[model samples]
Target: MVRRRLGDAGPGGRGAGRSGGGYDEAQAQAGAVLRGERKPTNPLTAGQVHVAFKCHNGKHIKAESNEELRASSSVIKEPEKFEVEHSGSESIYLKSHTGKYLTVDKNGDVHASGVSASDGSVFQVLLQENGLVALRSHCGFVAAEANGRIRANRSLIGSWELFQVKDRSRRSRTEHPGHELPEPDEQDDAPAFFDAFCQVEGILTAEERYAKTHHDRTAVLFDKRVRSRRRDHMEWSFKHFYMEKEYPPSFRGCVSAWDITRVEMDADGESDTPKAEDTEDAVRPRTRSGSDGSQVVSFDGLEAGRCHWKKILQEDLTDAVRIIAAFGVPAASAADADEAAWQRLLAAQAGCKQKTAHVLVMCSSGLCKAIGPIGVDCSPWPPALDAVFAERFAGLGAGSIRLKFGALPGEAYDVDKDPVFLAWKRAAGPTARGEDWVLQHADSRLAEFEAARSDYERRRLSEQVSTAKKQLEMAREHGLPVILQLPAQDDAERCMAELLVAVFGEASQHPILLSGFNGRPKCAAAFLRSFPGMMVGFNGLLTHSKHKQSLGEVAFDVPLDRFVLESLGPQYPPADSAAGSARGSYSHPAHVLLVAEELARVKQRLPRDILRAAFSNTAKLFNLSI
Candidate 1:
């Protein structure tokens, strides 16, 4: 038994430690203030207070005379001012200037009623970092605004639970009590601004913390700052290059390199015909009449550095009947004039009306020519060499374009000297046909590359599937979501298909996400056909020229469950283009930041459910502590 001291009840009535004592004292003070028996001891000089809450839909909490609190967007001419009386401890009792006290009911509805500081009328004032205050009812629910009404409902503190309390009586700076203002600092404010920006953009919530967690095991390692830098660089690049055309919808899924020369040619060809003098410094052609009344032009280079002759010959000569190409010209006195003459000759050939023209473009690699159809004939070279050339010329035109393969009379196919050629030949096999190269050999080589990539994916998925299956088998496994990330390749699909077949019946019942196969619609469709229930996603940046053939077919063809914009690490090769290389390599930090910024923008544009589910799945996979 504890003895009560006289000081415990002196003046204040009961001990401060007692539970009901604070409420009784607060109630007496509130009653005194309401009855004009005592002056309110609140620090804030209030006549009319404007309370703004940080709800999903930003609106102000307003109180009408003798009515419940509600959120409103309209401006109140005469707002109700509360006589804020300080209660014992960190609590307060707000009495409306109209002789009514703000009280909460059993249902959490707040209304202006009697002046007695009952448990409903007493509120704990919680201060937040953003200079906002939270009002918590004695019933352990935070006073929050939801759907245009003020109610005490939230158990955890969040942006929605906070309110900005301002004293209207001291609205003007001159009339307000003097106080020292904090010094302005740009560096300190940047993080706050960034956090607010991220919150508003839905990339992060107010309660979410940013931690430097490694995401290497995921599709790509994303850095928020790097993403911002990438966005800035792209915008600058677009403006600097004066590129005005909108991105073709087909190109959006894959990372690609654009030929500035081809873009210039298209632009020029669309508006005006390029003149002979326009290309006088680039190419020179000496023409002679053929036996069949056709023109045969032998193109020569005067200067080595005058133009990218290889690019022009490779890209522009697709429509030509045959190409005789050569490289490495000996230093000559009249190199500039000779190059100018060569450009004039090529320009003449470009404007020529002859259909069966045989053009020779010389380079360092000696003279090479294409015979037969205007499109590339892959029959000359090995299947592997043809595949390489096809990738190089992918951006040139439409249809099944093949590269001219095999060696001419002077040139021998040197598989011993070139390691790349040797590897290609080994992969293509002897039976591989060059005529159906793009369909057969190229696809086969792509399959081989996929196989190599999938080896690791297969191992990883095998372990993950085994683990997930075991976890599902464990007791109380309900609501536990599992996500498996597989490389966007056929082997991955094959491996997944095999593994999933065993657990197909069990997997269909649980929440499981299948990521990294969204780049190809056919692949995604295949997975969906097999599983019919698994959620699928893709890494948007992984699809390159090797996958370009199927890119257009998948563009807007199938609806994706998720779209993940992943960052190819700093060492990832730039897209195959002169302009892309000139832009310089991306740093690791810049890569991550750019990816994060892009992810945010993508989130804003994509469907809400897909993004939400993707993020949830990612968090589950990475166990992100943030």
Candidate 2:
């Protein structure tokens, strides 16, 4: 019902909202495209626009090849901070100083420099991640998707990150090309991939969310699930918890403190669009797809600060009503025709003691305007329903918060498309062992491992893996149950061919739990024969795409105490590491179970404690607590 007259209709074309004129396919595509050629979304940067632009003189330089001269010419203005031809500019943050970078708190990775800074500087990349192989494939699902036009404007929205891993005082080695390997002492942190994934499969998005211009492993957008009713409506959901009563005016200003719950994209068109694999349908530009798409293409902290970051991006407003029903709500827009109906919609939630989850739905166009630098509403919840909060079940506790949109086929939010496979590929492109010279290929690498059911593989160097076990023994000497990060299946499988017990000699008497890429035929049985009951029965399936961006990988196969918080959150202390955070103290399953047991005695009346005990028991029994 609103208007956004800005650019064209076609991909990479122009215009913003529909001009009251009818829809045209060609205009949509052309309008979607930007003024010139666009950059292909790539991994590495933490989602700061990573562009290598040419100056007005039409001269372009390769920062990678010519470091010195490239540093001089790279001092261009930040596009996000660009000014009009004659407009006054503001001097902020050292005028885009060199060596300045965006470091995603989630991971300790450091991308090179921004296009505005010198070539050697470090900066976050500002590009959409939907189509990229590495970023998209990292997690078990796609957390962010593009929006806008079928042609160009497709973008993303999330925390932009930047950092460099060069020798920085604390470490003696360089950062790139095998200089900094995993430390033998630290382990226990899971890779900071995406935190939690969207459960919806096959929903369409007018707007998509990105992690960073690149990848940050805080959480996965989804696990894997087939759709029972994916045909009904394509949609996604994300939740962000804000401090009750007081929050910064906008997230842009306080983004560093906020935890992004989940980002998922419904690649389909409208919610009602039939689920089909036609990639052409997904080709629409992100902006035109609606605010969801726009945010995906262009991540914004400033805009989210200005407005309250509330949006509903479904093309047909009715989609909101249908999707909210999952939470037992029903209403569309704050209209006058149905006051009673509105109350029914707002009051229709179950009264469960578990914390209520808050969700925001956006129609494509609505979300676009919400983030635009123009006029729009900027509140957490719609003003019209201000009176409805006191009595609603979903609004009871301020714990869970999320944003979602209708999805289309190939929507990253869709559960039908394998989340693990899709996310892993996006985050760590071609992780398959041998495809087109890529370190990992999708076919042989992924499928072969998935077939293995989650087993560990040891590549001949038992010294490193064996040393990790020794550390576990050291921790056990201290009465701490150790967490051993079994290497991704391949790393463990290499040792199978060895005839000498000298390699895995530690397993000669004590067997460890069989996990990670365990689908290798009889892999667990072989270990049982060698070690006898030494193996724990936990499903330790980890994707090959993992580990590269996660601390979990570095800690894998090593004792948990060896894990360190080198990256972002979801970090746990290795069983033997010096305790700093509560999470670190309770990193291992044995410690967690012990803590829960202690709580069971102290917190005798709390109902959730029983649940906690159940969880603790299972986690310790399987060694899959992470």
Candidate 3:
């Protein structure tokens, strides 16, 4: 059973007389503190506040996933933060960042394991004259050991019992009546609430904030590998993404294993199905020789679109061993490298003297690869066959895989509309090795679509319309959210609305993400009308002066909860120049912060509030642990 640390001054204290009958006076003193009749010498007050504890030895106390409390980590990650809630008088409840409350076990070991405040969850704060505090339990005073574990079996106060608490109340998400001003000596990771937003302050402020706090932050990579190994090993790593342009070491986020499908237009500007070689059947032949010597074609419905699954699986298994070898984790065979296995590896890694834990995987999208393959090339196959394949894949993932539907932007055009793309298509003839041509006309491609305004309006709307309908149908059938990136065309909205209504019924609650929205305000509201749970995504376009007012209008009209922030990465840098950002200056992860600050300026809300809400919305959509 869980235990709390209420000592002689608790409810039991009302009856137990000790220390020359000071119980009544102690009770009265605690009451005074709770009622604001008296202030404790320490900074803590009656209300709840976010806080971090620094031990006498100067190490910060961190909450481990295993529930044990330890004072070992020097850097303050999310787990290190705690919410201190006033229970009564001098008694308080400490909750970990993950929502678990600190509890004392029967054996006196303190763990952040309480689901809710109950018997071993409460503790009385003993504010000391030295501006430090100690917690007392019925068993003994709480203490931090030099070995990094926390326990409450100490009978008397000692150096290990005292902890210097710093108020991090500004970061709290609870509804406090008021917040105390931060100390002047407190580190300014970004502009304080007092500072107003300005153009000059956006990116620079974000860069400074990233340098100070997020240097060790976890980042999500989409089918990309880290460029270089850090001095400290990562929790995980995999070979993923573009061979030359990989993520920087400072990149912090989650990892995704992505099966890629490139959308290409024919010379006459028609959507072409991916070549047979790009299909799953082409990569791994479906026919197998039976014992009777006849050829048999396997009809496994679950393996649709996943032509490269075996290859991916083999590489991932090999990479698991590579990570273990590189990080000096306990040896393990490739056979034991699933999610739980990876967690065990990390647990062992954390047990060592390493400063950081890294878990790397080379994939696009998020965890669990049972979703098979994802793409828009199910054509030439029967509708019934496609549906069965999609359903089987969806069932295997069990909601782990999300449907990502990317629509053409407003300026999107057929290759026939651009001489360069058209010429490239003619020369390449829908081949796989045409990326060089794409690189050559990168800037002019989107611009030329605007030049063929009439053609773009008609073609872009119909471009992926059929495939989108099919994807949405699959998503609706499986109750999976669709991360839909809409084209910039206004008709694209109408087209999507019609498709959504047709697929999921009118005004369905199907979760959808409208990513990189560069469209009109009317279209956004109309699209929202069709799917209420849809969220609009704003990318680096938020930082552009030309798109400022229009996007800002959309931001204003839409409910604040229905918006999310994104960065186009290096593709859409703040610099207006189409070329030459100079070597080593193309990194743009910090630009996400600039997007947040700009959105805050448009909404006239606190940057932190906007950032917090945006992050929460994203986490909810992605089902990520924040």
What tens-digit string does per-residue lDDT give for candidate 2 at 1-626?
Answer: 00011111132112113364222432243334433244433333222223332221112212222121121121222321211111112111111123333111222222223344332222223333222221111111111111100011112332111111111112336645568754321111111111111111111121123221223331123111112112222322222111111111211110001111112223321132322551322432222122212232212221122112222222232221211111110011111112332222222221222222222232222121100000011112322212332232122110111111112211222221232434454676665432332334434433322222111111112123333333233323322222222333432333331311433343443223232222232333243334432322221111112221121211222222111111011123222112212221212111222222222222222323432333333234223222
Clashes of each: 26, 190, 28
Ten residues in sequence with the least summed lDDT for candidate 3:
323-332
Instruction: Give all candidate RMSDs, comma-separated.
Output: 27.8, 30.8, 23.6
Which prediction has more favorable lDDT, 1 or 3? 3
| lDDT tens readout by residue for model 1, 502-580 | 5544235343445333334445544444444445433323234554334323322323343332322223322321111
Total backbone clashes of model 3?
A: 28
- lDDT for each candidate structure: 0.35, 0.23, 0.47
lDDT of 3: 0.47
- Residue 373 in model 2: lDDT: 6
Q: How many Å off is the CA of 436 in candidate 3? A: 22
Best candidate, lDDT? 3
RMSD of 3: 23.6
TM-score of each: 0.23, 0.18, 0.36
